[model samples]
Target chain A: MSRALLRSVLELRPAVPRPIASPRILPATQIRALQTQTPRQFNPTAQFVDPQPRPSQLPEQSTSSLSSSSQREPPKQKPNPPRVRLPTTPPEITPQKLDPSVKSLLPLLAAQPAHYITIHIHGRPYLVTEGDAVRLPFLMPDVQPGDVLRLNRASTLGSRDFTLKGSPWVDERLFECRAVVTGTEQEPVRVMIKKKRRCRRKKHVFSQHRYTTLTISEVKVVTEVPEDA
Target chain B: MTIRGLPQISTGRNGVGAFILQCKRLDFHYCDWAGSSRGMNGFIKSLLPKFAAAHPQIEITVSPRPRKHPVVVGHYVNGKTKSIEVKNMEPMQVLQKVKLLRDASGEKDKRTTKPVTSINESVRGIWSPYHGNGMRV
Candidate 1:
């Protein structure tokens, strides 16, 4: 009876390897049945599993539940993409009414071909037409090659037949002028020798200045004027 | 028989229709053994790949020049070339030099007093005493 009790205790322990088969270990099959009835405590490959549900959709405890429950749920659809935004120039404030003479002659000027404009930059005037190249006296900062610059300040806009001269400055609504930054150019280096009378020492100073280059892309005069003007 | 040239009716101007970059190619030469080329070697290994990828139009070539200082040469579409010595320069400084070369117009430097240069004829005809209604003297 003591030997039978020892065999029952050995069957109760689950650590016994399954490969060992003996007539005394007939209770091992009963132990296998008990193991199949219990749920899995942990999964070693759970971290490497693909198609896992998003963390926001399920809690950690719910994720550990039976895999069959997850298969019964429907697949989630992807969210819609955001709309694209395009860059545009900001609109200017409400423009003032054009002078009666300007209103009448602007159409005539616009009809003529090959126009030129006197564009002012930093209070300096530069008379340029389309396809002309201008090298600014000072280095223009924060500008890159291929950038289009809209020149708004102008003192004069004229064609072959008619000329529109502004009173100090022209209204920007009448015409459009655009230029593209090409590159920068430097002047030849200059050397100035400083000397004093009866002094054996002389100092040499070298100076070079860089200038920004731009090509006039467009010089157009609007033909239509507001009826209210 | 007299030889004559073709009469040109139009001039070809850049940026009038399509814009083309002046810089076409860049050559980087570095000395592996010299201490002066240490920064250049680093720039070639680290920064050059990204720069070449960014400017696909510019053809870039890198090669070693033993026992000499590092030099960069830029070839332009106008058939002019500019070279800059980058010995003892940091990577960023060398990058700035390269940008300067890329932006150049490939023309010889000269002092210019006028801002605007145009080939187009003036909108208002030139003044002449021989033409138009005679002005009151």
Candidate 2:
């Protein structure tokens, strides 16, 4: 069948090169290149690096001392942008010194089975527990589905017996809260009618908005306090 | 004799364990002899192949609907279908619409006032004046 033949042809074709890291961290020019270059779209700047390096490339570069040598140095290795990986260990932040009363009552707060946190994103507070769904008002850019976001800014963390209220914002080191980016949701299209008193023409304007959806995956309150704190 | 109900503890939440795209399939319909399907035909010839290859998870099918405007129908895992009429639009514009359909969650649109919704009971139990120690005002 023609479909099988097409599949075979597709299988024989070379795979597209994937970037070493996320495209978001790239410079503005490179990010623009990535955003503009769709599949099969013609882009003069997009070039593929040779997978294997040639043995004589070094000697060829050194021997060719022509005026335009700098322009034609080598195409084997494109300068890969430096990648930033997620931190493996907890980062050092401003430590909080717990009062004697808070230290004693903290055990009782941690003893309770359930806890809740009011996390803030973009200065908006969301009171959520684990397994809750949150649809942010604005579309979150540079995040894909299933990406886990750490909710560090919080005003309150509470349990059955106790509540820790922050003065504007809480210490990020005290608890861990994470949310997974679910897909996006769109509102129905709004059509507005516009007309002028003298003119008979009527204009209809259409607009639709999208919001990013997220689900709280994990919410854990650290039970033990560090010796220094 | 005493009867008991089934014990169910947990509910399924998407993106909690593993995330699956809501759009399951995309059906593109075009007419061979219609003038309105000019852009749709061009898209089917040049762009759809690349789009289909990029998203192997979504099942794509192109069929002919004679003497009618071109339409793009999206089928979701939630057992809902959304169809958009793409008559007289350019191929790039149609591509944008296709991306819109692919990203949608397939739920009916509603104006949401609250940011968070949770089913879990409140962590702090309701306080009653009579139960706790009496306080002097």
Candidate 3:
């Protein structure tokens, strides 16, 4: 019964009153001032206020004194020392011409199907072919993954039919040999036990070392000579 | 002591391990009736056989080009050709020119100002303004 009475009361209530229209006329300047003042009241902190004192705020006499002092002082001159130029690396010595016999036989050797090369890196010899994975004795410094290193020094470049041997080191411009740095690999931990002869003192030392891994990406006898070649 | 082995592959440099001659073919063009062909005919008859025997890698062809000056055209592996006129020249002079062509790398002759030409990075890195202390006045 009370719910029915509440519903009937709510239905009997009059609709909300619309805003009443005031016929008061304000001047254009007054309306503009009101519009401008509304935003300032809405956000009081919106305008930026610089913390430092502006030049305009200084007294004219002080400003003139400051300007006069600045004019009186000579400009600071920086003495540029002459740049020290370092000597660049010397150019590679041009190689001697090929022997007549070797020149005649080169094409026959190049016509072979497959070839292998013995390359030297840091005075270590590595007999490798294309797509071979090589593990160097020591970690290669200053090299990152995906870095391509050109193997310039080779002792022998040969195939089943022919072999081209170099005296001590081969010329670097003969072949196109590339190695891609794969990543660094870590070895298993090695533990060494140390003990004193007289005393019962014992110590265990554990060690693990990392090595850079590389893959022989390409090894091709450059048949076509490039512009610089 | 931990034993670690780094993986590395051999890099091949052309002319380092072995040099492939750039001049693949030499074409000798001579005129039969022209007086300029006199020395060229002598070179073809006397010196060409020895030259061909010395450089088996290079293919040699002799063709008669009527009314034209005798020219030795060197076909390079880089798809460029260098032609030298051997008109009225001695056989030895023609051989010298042939050697020059044989040794040529097939690129246009360029004046290289720098002494060293390399693909490798500079040993001393570039100077940067952001690094090192600034000079005070």
lDDT by residue for model 3 (A1-229), tens: 5554344323222110000011111211101112210121222121123233222212222223221111222233236532322223234658755555655666776787667788777666777776666656555543434445667778988776677788876555567677665444445577899998998988999976555555666777765433343
Q: Give the higher-TM-score candidate: 2 or 3.
A: 2
Q: Which one is best on DockQ? A: 2
lDDT of 3 at A160: 61
Clashing pairs in 1: none
What's the CA RMSD for each of the models?
Answer: 26.0, 12.0, 40.5
lDDT of 1 by residue, A102-186 (tens): 8888888998888999988777899999999999998764344555667877899999878899887788778888777778898
By TM-score, highest first, what's the ranking?
1, 2, 3
Error of 1 at B9 (Å): 3.2
Chain A superposition TM-score per model: 0.58, 0.60, 0.56
List each candidate's DockQ score. 0.23, 0.34, 0.01
Model 2 complex DockQ against the native: 0.34
Chain B TM-scores across candidates: 0.89, 0.86, 0.79
lDDT of model 1 at position A168: 75
